[model samples]
Target: MKLSTIALTIMLGLSSSTMAQPKDITIRLVETSDVHGSFFPYNFITRKAKSGSMARVYTLIEELRKKNGKENIYLLDNGDILQGQPISYYYNYVAHEKTNIAASVLNYMGYDAATVGNHDIETGHEVYDKWFKELNFPILGANVIDTKTNKPYILPYYTIRKGNGIKVCVIGMLTPAIPNWLKESIWSGLRFEEMVSCARRTMTEVKAKEKPDVIVGLFHSGWDGGIKTATYDEDASKKVAQEVPGFDVVFFGHDHTPHNSVVKNVSGKDVICLDPANNAQRIAMATLTLRPKTVKGKRRYTLAKATGELVDVKELKADEAFLKHFQSEIDDVKTWSEQVIGKFENTIYTKDSYFGNSAFNDLILDLELEITKADIAFNAPLLFNSSIKAGPVTIADMFNLYKYENNLCTMRLTGKEIRKHLEMSYDLWCNTMKSPDDYLLLLSDTQNDAQRLGFKNFSFNFDSAAGIDYEVDVTKPDGEKVRILRMSNGEPFDENKWYTVAVNSYRANGGGELLTKGAGIPRDSLKSRIVWESPKDQRYYLMEEIKKAGVMNPQPHNNWKFVPEEWTVPAATRDRKLLFGE
Candidate 1:
């Protein structure tokens, strides 16, 4: 089983248990994060057996509940459950009239409380608002505030009382960097507060009003050092845990890396932090024990022990009752996923996109150009490693071909801005190959917890331009790598001339900082640059266009390639094996 970096042992501030007159009290929290709709043991997209599922997590939770009693065990989740698979899309769009399968499943699992993730917000207000209404327990996001009222859009915190007169207050906050990725229409009227500021303010409120014995932070943010701007931090869980004094245990997600650590708060108190990676593969469990003590001749509780670990759920079989309970919904999603959407004349692998122009991304780029009739197009591979074979394509294949439900965006960009954007992308993607032996890809210097060869930046941010002939000189520095020769149609590419560009909604809204940092466009002024946006998502159009075509012969545009082949050719082959083990 794969386990993420387990940093440190659990450290306790305080704990409570449910034993009428017990000498020591122990409280346990079982947390799952970024499940991404992996409900069953089967992978709906792959049509194969996968490592983890919420059904398995349910089995483990049931075992723990039976052993510890429900009163002492609290089931928690750290969101991002609304996207990623055909099942979520089914419930999100197809079965909108019915209750969301996510709500039903989490409700059946008896989740104590949960936090709203960025993807949940990405589903837009209609979907998340409906799911939020259907959930039996509250979903928290203290930092997500209503613009009009200046109050939290959702409940800031929820208090759960155990049978043994113990109050556990759970405060939830998500990453405040939503504006960088999402369009305003998706999260309209809600503003995100920075994690540290939000945590400090909420902590003060919790101490004053609730005055609970133990505080648990269920943050839908990741570890520190994600995207940091002067306004907000995208991954501020570590920062919040370190700065906020009252929290006993902090469970975070959204980075999709499991971790366990102990960090001292501002008051110099020990705080346990844990993050369970995405897809229900593992969960974080913290058992905190508090022993009775005397303070000023009064009965008080002192921390005895605090231990947390990442429990692997990969080996566990799917719980039969859980599968049976959601049988209808599961079957519906499977049927939808399996429905034939189109056919492919040849297979396209996303792996090739990393090297240069490939059919995988070119298909998307070509489709965008046809749809928008723009002079230029920009795209990046959404999936890390995925393929669509030369045969009948299903809805599942469309999901792999296009990951996010981003709308198609047609924007205007100058030829100079286009050059800058490509430079920034290659800077994140490829390293300066000074010699033939130097790596072509910009892999990270250090290994992450899972011992994987991590990229210097997210692959989804490695945008490449189509509709123009260009060469990226591997020996050149960051800003000077890309050299545009001419348009794909043999027209002169003037740097000063403006051209209509097709892009994904995320990019148009300033995701990956490509437009803002690379193209030198101001973030707030982005909307003015957009010429048009499709009503439906890119995925839907990709499916419809392919279906209309009868069969797609996927091929790379061959519009661009890496220069100094003496270094880049062998480097590409070596780096491919290093990254994919192929």
Candidate 2:
């Protein structure tokens, strides 16, 4: 049995537990997923953030180990642990020339095994290879195979023997959707097989070879109600529980939502599956008790008792020692925050649902217009939180509000394409005609797409600012909601007019498909047009501009109306009249 990091810490106590007819060693599986390289207690830019720090998690892990002997514990990270903020980028691409904070922290903390997530490939495979080599424990992913070697670089499954001599075979699998969203270069020669097939084959092999006491699947794919399809779904955890035999406890990820439920499969067997929320904001601890159970013909041990908790980091104090050690790194982020990169003239805030001349959307629009050098440009309205208070804004504020780290791209659009884009927005409202009461209606329809485009942080809500006048008829299909009223300069939009539009690369690459299906100027992909600006820096400047222009108005413009334009045979759209019912 390999001695885990915790076990190595208290070797003397571990020996006693080892010598005595080892009692059932309670394996404290501490899982942190989608950490995105948040190791320090303070935000790199803010220098004062208290929540979602890796050091705090480290403190808890240490405390947990002191309470529960090493042989009784293991830590696992369910992918998306690499990319997100500037620090990870700085380390992976610039400063340290490495991206293995996960490996370093896990090495120090003694994580037993982990699975890869989608964002891990964002910095490219070279970084992954460099960092992966430094891991003391196995970074398991049976699904991630290198075509060059035709073998799994990371360990697929690991059999961990608890202090009581009870062996548990844990298999790790990354999300099969990696190739779909990741850059081609990172996963160029790689392939993500179906999750079902991966789970089936790996579990079968582990059952035959290891034949351990309990089977655990540390999966990076999310639970999608296990809908048997080309890939997995939310129920995937349950589906694996039902379909994949020999697995008792399953830890899932990628959704970044918390789900602590014990679901049973069709075989009259129950398995506990848990998904810890992202950002190390929450830690999931699952306690499993190994007990004997009978199969068809033989007696075997199985995971009998399973219970878990989502330990909020807010409840834990910041580990001052760890902060002191990483002080330089933390200070570097603060410096990055204070650097003035750009500026704006005055505030341009708005209240309309689509196009506004508000401080937030106006800045985005101005950037889009300036970058694209277009006569008119459009932007998505993001409404994550209420307006920034009358004070200085920070980078953390930008990241929190404009969570997506999207690449900048520009494109050429025709009048037809512009209409199509507006139509898409109209369709969004039309679809929610009946459910106008749902505050998060647009977010629900667009979150997955936005997240894929790394536009989670770029999200805006409430008012929309447009360069053209548009009317939406809720009675029509989604495509015909908005009627072009006029253009920004009060010029009538010519359907044949060619226009250049600046947007993030994600949007250009059919992010929301806002410009994809249009009978207009064929989009010309401009790779280096829109510069990726720092959210924090932008927000800080925005605060200054807001103060300069004390009184602001984000008034509503209900001038646009949705008249049925698509369906000749009008079908019941959202089963409602007003887009936003009074």
Candidate 3:
């Protein structure tokens, strides 16, 4: 053979070998955040089948797995899955077992990894510690560190491999505000670090050590405005995506808002951030395309395209097999929730609480004062429009009345501080009416939407004070709205006089900035102000109160009202009709 022909033959053989290499692959990541224990199609509170549930999400997951292939998909949960409905509460407290129903369901669903949420911590170590150990997949939280070892209390992150030569790393972080809303005893021996600093440090370490192809962030915090300072970084997912360079995709929860968008990172590259909302309404889907490349005689993969979007599971069918597996537990919880504990002589509704003193809210205040022996009590309607018809009261009714697992806390506050707290609460609850035609309550376009007419602020934070005669003047500005008359026992109100006040642990720990901002109490000093605290959840105490009372009658204390009823009543009436309809 000729020399030129031999060289050409060798070149052709090398080219053919390169062309026979395996093609590039694609991987899909599916995530659910803030499931909040809505596993079944049923709404345990209303006792009706709801549109959003984990059962529906399972169907969506099965479809994606089949389409993309099981090995090419990653299934993750972003936390807040241990509390909310009767089923979770039953497994958490009522039934003492080796594994919880929430853990069982997630394990059976084949979750690749998960994270811990604030609510999951609210279940205390007894519940979450056990549930964490029972899970098959790794539950991560890099920011939750043990004080003794000064290391991560849980698995910080998990690294998994997909089709040939591709490695994906998922790092998890939770909001550092756990100390602000929970007592020290609940989260003892562990400290939650600020998310931005934690994320930056963790990502740097993971990139150096793992050197994976793609980095996914599973954050249990939400994306708020551009506030990234340590003290005010409750929701820092947006800041992390914008400031951190290694993250390719970020998933967030804890705010209960659905979002899917791209933000610029430190390197000026676009990074996808997604939130699937709460109650299993939607699932976040991120699709990444990888292509093989040969550099310096080494084969590697490069991420070509990355996109994130929320997929609604409302129209999807429930996974029948999964539901059938837990049918017996579901039925037992339903039976326990329906067991009658007491009787109400008259029906009370939550709508009345927005206007002034209402039987619905006062009933809770009465329970707090009775149990704590405090001079005054403060509470708000946790549910927006829940009501209990006169006659039979069941465990379900207790859940509707007190939605959270907050413990009852009694704190010492002076009269001046109490007045200031009420001013802040009413400022968020009502508006300064320029005239009768103006709206009494602050309602935004989103609140007035055709689907729902809710308040701009969470109605649960619109607190009302009992055991004192007061008036809220809507004509005045925020700080000057409250006017205290006298105590419920007929003593003149004194700003300097100290009094024992009963509030939920959420407020006592400054969850809504009520105690810190309104009462002028430092956030760090909140725990010192607690005079007494209930052993169990406030709802448990309320249940015991109802059983002791036997025949319950929910009545308003009528200690406070909105001034200028001529202007306030008429405006509130019109707005209520517009907001709630008749």
Local accuracy of candidate 2 as per-residue lDDT tens digits, 10-40: 9978777667632344577888887877777
Q: Cα RMSD (Å) per model?
A: 8.2, 9.8, 2.7
Quick one: best lDDT, which candidate? 1
Which 10-residue span in candidate 1 carries the lowest summed lDDT?
A: 7-16
For candidate 1, what is the lDDT? Answer: 0.89
lDDT of 3 by residue, 109-185 (tens): 88989999999999999999999999998999999999999999998888977645678899999998888788888
Alpha-carbon runs more than 4 Å astray in model 1: 1-21, 292-301, 445-453
Candidates by lDDT, descending order: 1, 3, 2
Question: What would the TM-scores of all predictions be?
Answer: 0.94, 0.73, 0.94
Runs in model 3 deviating more than 4 A are 1-19, 163-165, 225-232, 294-299, 448-453
| Tens digit of per-residue lDDT, candidate 1, span 42-94 | 88888888888899999999998898778878899999999988899888988
Q: What 10-residue stretch in candidate 3 is worst by lDDT? A: 445-454
